[model samples]
Target chain A: MKLRTAFFLNTNKMKFITLIVIITFNTILHSQSQTGLVQYGHKQSMGMGAPIGIDYNANLIFDNENSLYTFAKDSLEGGHIRESVYIEKDKDNFFVNSKITNKLGFQYYVDKENKKLLSRDIGFNYVKEEIPTINWEISDEKKDIGSFECLKASTEFRGRTYTAWFTTSIPLPYGPWKLQGLPGLILEAYDTNKEIYFYFKSIKYPMDSKIKIQKPNSESENKEWITFSEYKKTLINKHKKAIENGRMLIEGFDSADTAEDKYTMGNSYIEIFDNE
Target chain B: MKKILFILLCSFVSFGFTNERIEPISENESAEITLPVKVETYNFPYENGTITLTIFDNGICEQGTVTGTLSTHCDDDGIADYVWSGTICREHIDALIMQFNASC
Candidate 1:
């Protein structure tokens, strides 16, 4: 009878140990999957002097080594505004490709260890760019974004003067789109002209989400590998060629030639073209 | 037993909540529009007719009229009234109108 009681107690102890093990495993799995959502606003000229702005909710899928940034479908007003500008996922391979004609959404993959950045452009070109080191002039200006007290900083990048507000409390050197290299997460960034802006909406940390950082190799289309500088050169060439052909592709006017009336807006690049 | 079956039915019904289908333009068809108020016409599955939406650059809808056996039931049931006459943001409104114009 004593042996039988010992055996029963031992079985209960093993069951308790197994339950603890299962709970611990679940906690680890949950911690590994974290996603942060940033609602960003993009303002650009759909036509000359016709600036339009739209709000985009994007996700920053974080892992130990890397993060994936992509736009979430607009959830406002029952998604009344369809996601016209977005990356198309190749169904067969699940590789996301940019729409070349519009060049709407670009993808960036950052390697934290090596500080290397890989960006895929509209024409399916993979540009390996070194993460730009910005010399930000931190200012005494202070403001509150949500509950965090953010500090003001300014820097010039790619011919555009940008003013950024960052919060060191987050401790993650990240930002919306390709804007990073700050001491902390960039809460807001915009050009002097306000032509480009990324404003923080909200953040959800310790989230239960998994982000599969997709590899660009799954693409069926021939991946054109180029540096960021080379890709810029190609982009400039494409725009110039389009202008030289005596026609420009306007947003709404498909196949309708409005070049005579200047209905097709020229490239409103924030950085003025310099001879240098 | 009846209560259990009813609860199961409610759970199944709750699972049916999904985004309303907004079909995109066809391959051969272009989604471009002429400035002021011109758009290519197409059919929406929910609506019984070919819908043509006219809007300004600012996203103000002047028209969201339909022809041939039109029904407003699908849109009336939801927050999709902006498709008809309300001033919606033009960026998504253009695409939404274009999608409504396209038939799945």
Candidate 2:
């Protein structure tokens, strides 16, 4: 036989090249064990606050204890854009406060070295825009959430269509407010009209050891970055005259006589930019 | 021997189809919850009084003790007083009173 049929055709071409290198290393170890792990959950309820108030322009306040305030008028009026209320107390600790306005010729910049709180109009020095740079796209399907195991990713920056879900199993990649760079940690995100969702409510990992990380001063830093539709078209063209004078100050406003004269006030503003 | 017993039964059926096993809790399952308890009344424009409290558990506010005049305009003229007790856990007090009645 011609050398045993050329040694059985070279062992069937080395067993078809070892079954294509073990099926391409088992499809890259099954997509790296399905993207490792790091999925969390959270979606509490109780919100009625944030209803019109952005000190400087945009107004419409109705009060009876059903609060609704907003403020950040025109290109988010000189830095330190105000409108605070974070209150997280179980998966860590939190506290934020700032909703007092009406002092005129403003000039407040309390950047506890970037904790943020800037205001200016007393002598004007405005001109600081930049905030737009987010990109992601990791899909191939996989879901579980609530014991971890997620994937579905997306990104269309500035004009909306976020939709994130990351994981890698509890590897801490933070989320809830300023979304983070994924690889593992975005628990959940929304946009396509869920209005704005962000879920992933708990994670402690802090046994008797201080771990602080807060820094953002110098007008709460931001030399560049934009898109969220260029900060919502720079907040509707710099608060289109404070949203037309806060819809003419709530035209004939009378939220139940300011909720029975419990003294209610309102304001609104939204101007953010850094890039589109 | 029959081709080495068919290559050890095809390597134990390809290692039992690549080790498939996932449990995710299930010991004859059992879990239920329902919570809700409310009695609102808050108006403390910095302390001149009126806070009939009662929002227990999760963001707890129990019969919080405090009464009258603490002025800063009594919390900007909204009146200032307090009184709330506690006992929530009916599925987190009906999900915080359906997220404070927004019927979440």
Which model scores highest in DockQ?
1
What's the alpha carbon RMSD for model 1? 18.6
Q: After superposition, how far is residue A178 of candidate 2 from its true place, in Å?
A: 6.4
Residue A259 alpha-carbon offset, candidate 2, angstroms:
14
Question: Any runs in candidate 2 off by more than 4 Å, and if so which?
Answer: A16-18, A32-178, A188-197, A201-234, A249-251, A254-276, B1-104
**lDDT tens readout by residue for model 1, B1-104:** 53344334333322321112223557798765333333332222223433222212333323332111000111111111111211223233334333232311
User: For residues B2-77, could you state the per-residue lDDT of candidate 2 as single tens digits?
Assistant: 3244334433333332332222455677533223322222222213422121222124323222111000110111
Off by over 4 Å in 1: A1-35, A45-51, A54-56, A71-104, A215-220, A246-276, B1-104
Report model 1's TM-score to 2 decimal places.
0.51
Candidate with best TM-score? 1
Residue A131 deviation, candidate 1, in Å? 1.2
Q: Give lDDT: candidate 2, residue A276.
A: 16
